[model samples]
Target: MLLLAECLNQQGKSTQAVPYLNQVRRRAGLANTTAASQAALTDVIAHERRVELAFENKRWLDLVRTGKAAEVMTAHGAKQKRKYSYILPQAYNITSNRLLFPIPQREITLNPQLTQNAGC
Candidate 1:
């Protein structure tokens, strides 16, 4: 139910997603928030998902599946660079090609038709 709500919200159907999100809030014993706009609702959903699923190793996959990898990671990278001078600027350069896993060299060698993902 939570995942369905998130998918609907991410796809710009926040109105339709609200009921599912509310259901999740009720189950989790959290209060449902009233967002003024679609974007706000989307943010609320993302925040809930982040906190609810913390330390379960789901964040990166969620960001990538929702097509928010580049935008979120780029901003995170900038913040880290500013907060810690030792952090390299290029450490989190999240280009579109970097959103996917690269094909293994062994797999590609075994299958001539297989090609590596971009930015591998």
Candidate 2:
């Protein structure tokens, strides 16, 4: 199902991707996708991936791959109104450095040719 959705998305056929995405949605007891725009459809696919693949350890990588971790996480953090809110300001900064982890110091020391990643 996901393979079909991804193919259609890659082909710029978001409307066609709807059926495949909806199949997953329906199986999850959720309503079928009804997005009319490519961006909206892409969002639907990403959301389905999150719901359908929950706890398979893919969420963080998905967010980074889609370049949405900062925006989504920032918005989500803002919604929290309790003790957790205090950490939001310092957390979830979506910088270029944040996208990739810094090369480990040990690895860099072992290989002088290795360069440290930016924002480390």
Q: Per-residue lDDT of 2-116 in model 2, one digit per residue for the tens?
A: 6579679868988778888888888889888778887777777887888789889988888887788888776766666345745746665566677788899999999999999
- What TM-score does each of the candidates earn? 0.77, 0.70
- The segments of candidate 2 whose C-alpha lies over 4 angstroms from its true place after superposition are 81-89, 104-113
Model 1 agreement with the true structure over 5-33: per-residue lDDT tens digits = 87887788888899998888888897777
Pairs that collide, model 2: none
After the best TM-score superposition of candidate 1, give how far the Cα of residue 24 lies from its true spot, in angstroms: 1.8
Cα-based lDDT for every prediction: 0.87, 0.79
Model 1: pairs clashing at backbone N, Cα or C within 3 Å: none
Name model 1 segments beyond 4 Å from true: 9-16, 105-110
Give candidate 1's error at residue 64 in angstroms.
1.4
